[model samples]
Target chain A: MKINFPHRQFAHCESGVTANLLNYHGFPCSEAMAFGIGGGLFFAYVPFVKINFLPLTTYRIGPGSIFAKATRRLGIKVIKKKFGSPESAENELDRLLEAGRPVGAQTGVFWLPFFPPAYRFHFNGHNLVVIGKEGSDYLISDPIFEETVRCPAADLRKARFAKGALAPKGRIYYIEKMPVHFNLPKAIESGIRDVCRVMLKVPLPLLGVRGIRLLARQLAKWPDRFGEKQSLLHLGHVIRMQEEIGTGGAGFRFIYAAFLQEAAGVLENDRLIDLSRRCTAVGDLWRDFALLASRVCKGRAVGQDSFDHLAALLSSCAVHEEALFEDLRSALVR
Target chain B: MKKNDVPQHSGLLSGNREVNYAVDVDGRYILESSVGWEAKNIALRQAWEAIADELTVVLAEIKDGKKSALAYHMVKNQMDPALLSQYSGVARWRIKRHLKPAVFAGLRPADVVPYAELFGISVDELRFVPEELISPLAGLDQVEADNS
Candidate 1:
């Protein structure tokens, strides 16, 4: 049995899955729209929280927030369940498939057999939609893939139940109700305000723009503290978090820029178009930082000057982002 | 990024390579597969090499009886004790205790099942460090072959 769900490949997994599922349910949500409404853009450079033993440097909000926030703002009803046992989770997922409801699930990338071996890692928090089940294979709509794919039942189960940080624990979610109408402008305003607050007003020195500055300070000291090879590894990890891990492009700045462009149309506001362009420019700056950092990582450059240059780039990014979000907030407020 | 700036294909020879972003003719962003970006590929290789280095140190520690094989697998799987506890249905304290080489050596088969399953290896394999754990670049050769 299959639901004939349309699969659209997207840059980021959670927002893409949210948009696809919402569109499938007749809400016509685009990936950018879902991302914007969900307040997906964020920055945090937490030194204490370790990912793969390095400081956690995330470019966006945590997983599952986009889906939850977008659904809530749009007045969509959804059922979310996490199972304690694999058996109950599989049984329930099968039951949902039999009833023709496409389900969104959180899974670990490492356990999914369809993934290229190089892409498989211990990092969890991958999101996918299960559209069908045919005997032993489960039809999967993983957002990051270029096309929909299939997974064996055993692989699917293991992925869903994969152990480790951010484990899915057999989590499954699906829409139970769809709102007939929602206030696009209000939601957009709310989303903009939320992002502005996070970027500009978050009190923590380890989060928001402050966190970026903190990262810059710490990053500049890496060579002195950890030596050349280890410092390069640290730099490489930052790039990986920005470019390779689930970020659509330019550490999600491009995606959020796309969202702002769409918002300009939805709210019929000209200022947002200007902000969108600025956001794209910010994305370019992030790309520049990545390029430079990549050079350092590859051993093409070594010196205090190179590290200082990278740290300067991050500081500039933080300043630009702070100003951009402030402008967005003011534009929405008026 | 502009449509013109998007690389049509990746040039990476090893590691997990894919380009998840591109641009359409109209300059709209699109999702596309890429072999890998050159700089990113280099950085990823270095990152993996760093992990391999960490694993090497971890394996030596386990072999020297300073820590359990669990510590070796933990680093190999990129996990910490907190995360392992969450997956293994074991308490953090107990998991920490199990990290001692003495306690780990004394653990029965049943006690090791959850961890063995979590790492997708047999209990016997879990008890001893796998050969792949010795070199962090265990699978990159195959990736290079596939790319070639």
Candidate 2:
């Protein structure tokens, strides 16, 4: 028997899962609200970390973070687990599904058979909800898609235990108890403050707004250091991380802007609504950087759009984001 | 982003339309269904091209018998020796050594079982790659035909 679970798509997976799961448990939450309340925005360009032989350029916090943070702040008790073996993991998941509790599962994108073959890569951190099991297939509520999906139990097992870099190890989580009384305004305030603090005050140069600048510096030097082919590959990875597979670059910014717009209504603060528009403007700058960088990657730029110019465009994003976050902090103060 | 400005095109080749946040008439943020965007597609294409390039080079090396079938599988799966070792419980050095055609040829069925299991193939299937590693971009044409 399939548990009746409402499936709704969102721009990002973790937030979407959180929103859907919370909505199921009696708290009506949108994906944007979940993301904003969780303070899911992050920017890190660490050269030391490598994925598929390229340096890491992540736009948001890793998977599972949003659900964990959003739920914790909202005073929802959740049971989270990671099994040592795939067999144990499968048993636990099956048990939960039998009990009529829809489970949030973390899996690698590569082994999920339902995904478009071209889009499947070995990136290990993807989230989905499994609501039912019937005749060797599990029904899935993957947040990135419009409708629900299904996966064979064997393939689902493989995806859950997919190895290498952020392996899921068959991790499963679900809410234990949803809080009926929690401070929504305080949650919104803390979440916005966390975003501002991380954006503006992170001491590390390879994180926050500072990280954007670091990426800018490294990006300009790529052509000389790694040659044209490798530099273009690096550029492509950055764009993919931003816009591909819902990693949330400019897409995330717009989502956050939407969240802020909603936050304004809840808090009855007009400044927040204004700040949300500025957030969108900052997101636009990021989109501009992606467009220009893509042209550079395609070698379609005739002139004035060199890596140096791209660097300037990216640095501009960092500058504007810094300003936006600083303004956000003051907006939260009153 | 304006709702009108949202890219209504589906993914470059994925045949998926995704929700993107844009603004409505009164400037409220609304989720728009984006077919896809040119810039994002180009980036995705570059990745596929890189994979195709590496596969071509690896396939040539295998034809020359300098590398084993395992080498082709590894590159095709985007796995390095270190990563493959971690998953298959084989030592990285041994994985690298096994990539040599002669060494792979000397391996027994039992010795190849771990790799076959990891790749979800039989020991015999692991012994050789197909004549062609089809470019993922070509799948779009297949998808188009299926739709039509």
Candidate 3:
């Protein structure tokens, strides 16, 4: 609940979205974005189809697979840093790991935060990405999956991962560009990289738009001297500077509800009712019914329910019969 | 129903002198002979409505292909084995013991097909009845299905 932004670098909508989307498509765990997007996709049962989640594993990247392809497809670079407590040996490996990178580069530095007692669920071990900086505060997209939050760079003064004499007192986790393959599926690569596409937060354009623009601006400030596309940063700045526009962003809320209904329904069809039960973002009953219909389409055994049976379930939620049937019919096409 | 008067056995209890049997398919015997004998006809004609009734149901189910006919071993698997033993008038183990001989006595090797025709269950599932006893089970099924 305590959201804090950590210092980090840039993010792109098109590449990041497409890459991670592709990576998560076949993954057993649903895909979620740190900010902007909160919901992840999952298929409960594949009547005939099957997919392996191994391609998404961090340890398996190589030349020909989708993992390697994502790095090559997008110009995203990766860096890794390991942390050690200074009270131990005099090994120079820890210093060498943290020394070389340019200080203000628009780089996503992966670092281990000071293990907070409040955040320790399973041992204090964690992995996080620092994507931007606001004054002295580090803007981060933590993969903690709770909420996108920020914390002070000075907080890292106690940071075990930093390099110093007592630096060995803390630990440093491996940092890298969120492996692009870890971001999007290949199909939607060009359209929405860098921007986090969360179905749950789809209606909140402010959060979605602000999060991405800040990332773009941060990336633009990177010292790596590539003038490839300056227009991207300008656009990011324009949007990031805006006030809470359009009816306190209520239209965004409507769209968010529609998406939630669809997403929750998607979750239900997969027998993932627990996820729907946990969701508090959306308020639409038709979406819930659609989730049920989606389950049947995904080949779950809902027992002898025909199209008429489907329409009857939808009717309970006050959805029009024709529209319900149409949605049910369409869910099957996938 | 025609009944057979009790046969006389020497070791009898004080009050009861008769213990009647109702045998329709041929007759029931309490013989101690070690050797088998050829056919010798002794007529005590009685109609067994049981055998006639069961055969009627089995024949109908078979004709319509609702029941896939199988060899004794496979049929034994589907039916309750205890029932089969009771119908055959044999000890339970003897039912398993004589199964091959029973199947071979009535049917040819080419007659039984595997999964395509009948489901292969264990021999325990079979309900055995001598040709005469099958009727009561058939009536039971009809009664139960009707009630359901």
TM-score of each: 0.90, 0.97, 0.20
Q: Candidate 2 residues A115-196, lDDT tens each?
A: 8766788888899999999899999999988889989999999899888888998999999998879888888888889888
DockQ for each candidate? 0.45, 0.67, 0.00
What clash pairs does model 1 have?
B19-B34
lDDT of 1 by residue, A111-220 (tens): 88888655667667899999999889999888777678899998889889887557788999999988777888888778878888888898999878898999999999
Would you list the clashing residue pairs of candidate 2?
B8-B35, B9-B35, B9-B36, B10-B35
Per-residue lDDT over B78-141 for candidate 1, one digit per residue giving the tens place of the 0 to 100 score: 7788878877888899999989999998999999999998888999988888554656465765
Candidate 2 ranges beyond 4 A from true positions: A247-251, A302-305, B144-148
TM-score of chain A of each: 0.97, 0.97, 0.24
Name the candidate, 2 or 3, with the larger lDDT value.
2
RMSD of 3: 33.9
- lDDT score of residue A297 within candidate 2: 82
How well is each residue in B14-49 modelled by candidate 3, as lDDT tens digits? Answer: 111211112233422111111100000000000112
Q: For model 3, state the Cα shift of residue B29 in Å.
A: 92
* Overall lDDT per candidate, in order of appearance: 0.82, 0.87, 0.27
lDDT, residue A278, model 3: 21
The candidate that wins on lDDT is 2
